[model samples]
Target: MTVAVATIGFTKTTAENFFARLKAAKVKRVIDVRLHNTSQLAGFAKADDLAYFLKTINGMDYVPEPILAPTEELMKFFKTDKGDWDVFSRDFSALMKERKVEKALKPSFLDGACLLCSEATAHRCHRRLVVEYLNKEWSGALTVAHL
Candidate 1:
């Protein structure tokens, strides 16, 4: 069976819309793929508050998997270097390969999981790269939905 994995970003969206989208998708868990989820800028997306809200609002589980996140150096390069998406994607893909995330991450954890990040959309986010890399590694077994 093909595993269904969804991706979402919290910026430029309201808490009500965020929860509503997750509920609509029937996501069982949220995998936070952010390097720093507790930054003051995170607002409701902060780890502790996110966990609480996920449970209270939609009865969903929250899991912070930093292993799926890009390194600080990588993020700094992307943000500071005028954001070259191709170079960022190439480097991030290399990082994931080096980390062997395809082997380390369990399929069960991702089957019904939603990858969470701060980008308003998946077009220019590491979360998209992550899923694409995983799909390639898994032989296209993952059906990725960008939410």
Candidate 2:
């Protein structure tokens, strides 16, 4: 069976809409993939609050998996150092390869799992790259949907 995975971003969205979307998608768990999930800008998506919200609101689990996140250096290069999308994408892909994220993760674990990030959408987001990388490693075992 194909492992189903979803991706979502918190920015430019409301708490009500966010939780509702997850519920609508039947997401069983949320995998927080942000390098900085505790930032005040995270608001409703903050680690502790998000965990509580997921459980209390959707009866879902929250897992912080920073290993899937881009490194500080990579983030800086893309956001602060003015690196292009192509460069960031290549570097982030290399980082994921070097880290062997595919081996670290199991398809079962990702089933019904949704990747969480700060961007408003998966386009131009590392979360998209992550799912793509994992799909490749798993020989197209994953069926990804961006929420």
lDDT values, one for every candidate = 0.93, 0.94
Which lDDT value does model 2 have at 13?
86
Predictions: Cα RMSD each: 1.0, 0.8
Residue-level lDDT of model 1, residues 1-147, one tens digit each, is 689999999999999999999999999999999999995655899999999999999999999998999999999999877778899999999999999999999677799899999998999999999999999998888999999
Could you tell me the TM-score of candidate 2?
Answer: 0.98
Local accuracy of candidate 2 as per-residue lDDT tens digits, 59-142: 999999988999999999998998899999999999999999989989999999999999899999999999999999999999
Superposed Cα RMSD, model 1: 1.0
Using all chains and alpha carbons, the TM-scores for the candidates as numbered come to: 0.97, 0.98
Worst 10 residues of 1 by lDDT: 35-44
